[model samples]
Target: MRKIKELGEFGLIHKLSSQINFRASDSILGIGDDCAAYPVKSGKFEVISTDALVEDIHFKLSTIKPETLGRKALSVSLSDIAAMGGTPKRIMVTLGIPKKISVSFLEKLYSGFNEICNHFKVELCGGDTVSSPKCFFINVAVIGEAKRIFSRKGAKPGDLVFVTGTLGDSSLGLKLLAKNKTRGKDHKFLTTKHMDPTPRVKEAEILGRSKIDITSMIDISDGLVQDLHHICESSNVGAQIYEDRLPLSPELIRTCKRSSIPPLPLVLNGGEDYELLFTLPADGVKNLIRQFLKAKVLVTQIGKILKPGGISMKMKNGTLKVLPESEGFNHF
Candidate 1:
C-alpha cells in the first residue's frame, strides 16, 4: 500500500471518493462541493457537511483550552455550511474522548459548544461519543437550509472577487501562541481569532437574501489563494488578485511588523480565517458594496476572475506574476 503522506489530504480524498459511485436522486450534490446537498420539498436545499479536529494535528491542549477547542471544532463545520449561503439548523457532534481526561474538562468543552449553538440558534440534535485510547478529537456534522446555493462552479471570467472581514488574523494568532506570547491586547485579539473562530452565518444569510447577484462563494478555511484556486478550478477560469487590496486587521499588521514577518504571505496562504470569499458580476459590485455598507459589514474587492486556468498576483509596484503552487492545510 502507498503511504498516505505521499497523497496528501485532498489527493487521498479524491482517490478514495473516486472509487465510490453515488446515484441517489435526492442527493443533488455529493463528495465534491462544500456540502452534500439534498433538494427539500419546500423548494430550498438542505446542505450537510462534516469536519473533524484532532489532538496534536489541528490543535494542542497546552495552547488551547478545552472549551475553546469545542467551540472551534463546531465552528469549522458550520463554516462549511456558511459557504453555501445556508442557514444553520442543527449540528451532530461526535467525540473521540480520552479516558485520562477529566469529566470537568469535558463539561467545559460541552459548555463551549452550547455557547456557540445558542448564539447561532442551532440545535444539537444527535451525536455519538466513543472512547479513544490515544488522543482527543471532535467530528461535527452540520445541517443547514439554503434557498439559493452558491457553489464554487458558478464563477465566470468577468466576475469580481470579494472577501469579507480581514484575513490572516487566525494564522497570526497561531504564530503568537507558538512563541508563547498571548497576554497583550494585540496578542489576545489575534489569538482569539484563531482559537475561537466565528462562522459568517449572518453575513451569508444576508447575501443569499440580497438582490445583488453572487456568482460563487466559499469560506476561507484553506487560505485565500488556495480557496480561490478551488473556485477557479471548479469554474474553469483563472484569477488576478491585487496584493495591496488584501484586507488586514490593525492587530495583524502590527504583530507582523513587530515580529519582522511579512504580512502578505500570511494573508495569502494562512488558513482558518473562516471569512467568505465570493464572486459577483461586475455590474452588481456597486450594489453589493452599498448593501454591505448598509449592513455595517466589512468587505473588500481584492481580485477579478480571469480566462484560461491559473492564478496571478498583482503586486503594489505594478508588477504581475503567477502564483506558486500552494498546499493549503494538508491533513496528511
Candidate 2:
C-alpha cells in the first residue's frame, strides 16, 4: 500500500468510500454529504455534525492549550450548524489523550467546552474518553434544529454574496507566530488570532431569523475562494468576486506590510476564518446590510452568483481572470 501522504486527504477519503458498500435505508443519506441525515419522528428536522482536531495537524501543543483545543473542537462543529442555518442544541465530545496528560489539563479543557456551550445554550450530552498512543485528539458532534434548512445547492444566478467580518487574520496570525518564534518579535494581535477564533453564531442566528430569503450560506473554514467554490459547484453557478471589495482587517494589513507580503492573496485564500459567507437575493441586500450593521459586524459585498460555470476575480484594473482550482488544508 502507498503512504497516506501520497494519496492526500480527499483522495484517501475517496479511496475508503469506494471500498465501502452501504445498505440503502430511509434514514441514511450517508458518505459524501456534509452532514448525515436520519429520520426523526418529530415534525422538525434534527441535524448531527462532527469534527476532529488532532495535535500537530490542527494545532501545535506548544502554542495551543488543551482548553483552546476543546473550545475549537466544539466551535468547528458549530460552524457546520451555522452553515445549515440551524441552532446548535447539544454536543457530545470524545477525547483521545496520551497517558502522560494530567487530570487538571483535562479539567481545564472541559471547562472551556462548558463555557462555549453555556454561551450558545448547547448542552453537553455524553461522550467517551480513550488513551492515545502518542498525541491528543478531540472530536465533537453537535446536534442542531432548524425549521427550514440551508444547503449548498440552493444558490442561484444574480444572488449577491456577502461575508461577515474581515478575512486573513487567522492565516496572518499563523505567519506571525512562525516569524515571532524565529525572529524573537512579539506580535500580540497575530498570536491572539492564532490561539482564539470567534465563530459567527450570533450572526447565523440573526440571519436565520431575519427571513431575508437567503439562497445559501457557508462558513469559511477553508479559504474564501475554495469555500465559495463549494457553493458554486453544488449550486451549479459561477461567481465574480471584486478584488477591491474584499475586507481585510487593519491588523492583517499592518502585518502584511511588516512582512512585505501582499495582503490581497492572504485575504482571498487564507482559511480558518470561521466567518459566515452567504448569498441573498439582490433585492434584499439593503435590509441584510442593515441587519448585520445593527449586529455590529461589517458585512462586505464581495461578489454575485452567475450562471453555472467557473469562478472569476475582477481585478482592480477591471480585468476578469479565471480562478485556479486548488485545495485548502488537506488532512491525510
Candidate 3:
C-alpha cells in the first residue's frame, strides 16, 4: 500500500474517513462540517472548535511578528464559527513556548489575541501554558452559539455557490515574503492578509440573521477548490466553477502582475484566505447577489452544485477541464 505522503492531504483525509467511527451523541455533526455542534438548553446549540499553530511550520519567526502570530492563531479558529453561521462567545488558549522567547514577546502576542477578541466581543475564559523542548506551539479553542446550524451535506443540485471577498492575495503575499523583496503599493495589504487574516464574523452574522436558507457553508482556510471538494464529497455532488467569474481584488491582480505569477494557481490553491464559500438555492440567487452588492462585499456566482461525481472548471475559451487534486495543508 502507498503511504499518505504519496496520496497527499486530500487522499489521506479520504482514507482516514473510512476508519473513524463518528459516534458522539453530542456531536450532531463532526469532521464534515465547519464546527462540531452539541445540543444546549433553550433550543440553542453550542459549537466547539480548535486549531494549532507551530513555529517554522504554519509560520516563521523571521518574517511574522509574535503579535500577528497570536492574532492568526485565534482568527483561524474563529473562521470555523463563521462557516457554521454561528456567533463566537468565548475562547481558551494553550501555549508551548521555548525558553529563548522573552516575556515582552509573549505579552505582545497576548495583546494581539486580546485585540481581536475585543473586536469580536469574545471573552478569554482560561488556558494552559507550558515549555516546549524545541519550537513554539499555540492552540486555541473557541465556543460559539447557534440556534440553527449549517452543514456541508445540505447542498442540493442546481444550487449556486458563492465566495466572500477576493482570492489569491495571501499566496501572492507569501511569495513576496519568500523572495525577501517588496513592492511599493499593495504590499501592506497583501502582507497583512498573510500575517493577520480577518474572520468574516459580521458578514456571517448578517447571513445567519437574514434566514437566507443557506444550503452549505465553509471558510477558505484550505484552497478554494480543495475546500469546495469537502462540500461535494459530503453532499455526494460535484461542481463547475467558471474561471472568468471568480472574484479577484485589484490588489491581487496588481501583485500577481508584478510578481509575474499566474493568478489561477494562487486563487484556486492558496490557503488561509479566510473568506466564506457558501451555496444557496437557484431561486434566491439574484436576491442574495443584490444584498451582497449592497453590503459592498463582492459575492461572485462562480459555479453550481451537481449530482455526485467529479469537479470540472470551465475555461474562457469554452472548454471544460478537470481540476487537479491537491491538499490545502497537512500538519504531519
Local distance difference test scores for all models: 0.84, 0.76, 0.79
Clashes of each: 0, 0, 0
RMSD of each: 10.0, 10.1, 11.2
Better of 1 and 2 by TM-score: 1
Candidate 2 CA-lDDT value: 0.76
Q: Where does candidate 1 stray beyond 4 Å? A: 1-41
Candidate numbers sorted by lDDT from highest down: 1, 3, 2
TM-score, per-candidate, Cα-based? 0.87, 0.84, 0.86
Q: Give the TM-score comparing model 1 with the true structure, all chains together.
A: 0.87
Model 1 per-residue lDDT tens digits across residues 23-114 = 33455556556655555658889998999898998999989998898789888888999999998877766777675666557666877877
Off by over 4 Å in 2: 1-43, 181-186
Ranking 1 against 2 by lDDT, winner: 1
> Over the stretch 1-332, how does candidate 2's per-residue lDDT look in tens digits?
45544555455445434433322244355545554455564655676789988887888877777677767788888988988888887666677767566655666677678667767777665565676889988888888887667778888999999998888888877876665542323356656665677778788888878879989888998889889999999899999999989998777676677768888767777788888899988899888988888888788899999997889999999999788648455554
Q: 97-170, model 3: which lDDT tens digit per residue? A: 67676655766687777677778877655566676888989999989887778877789989989998889888
What TM-score would candidate 3 get against the native? 0.86
For candidate 1, the per-residue lDDT at 141 reads: 91
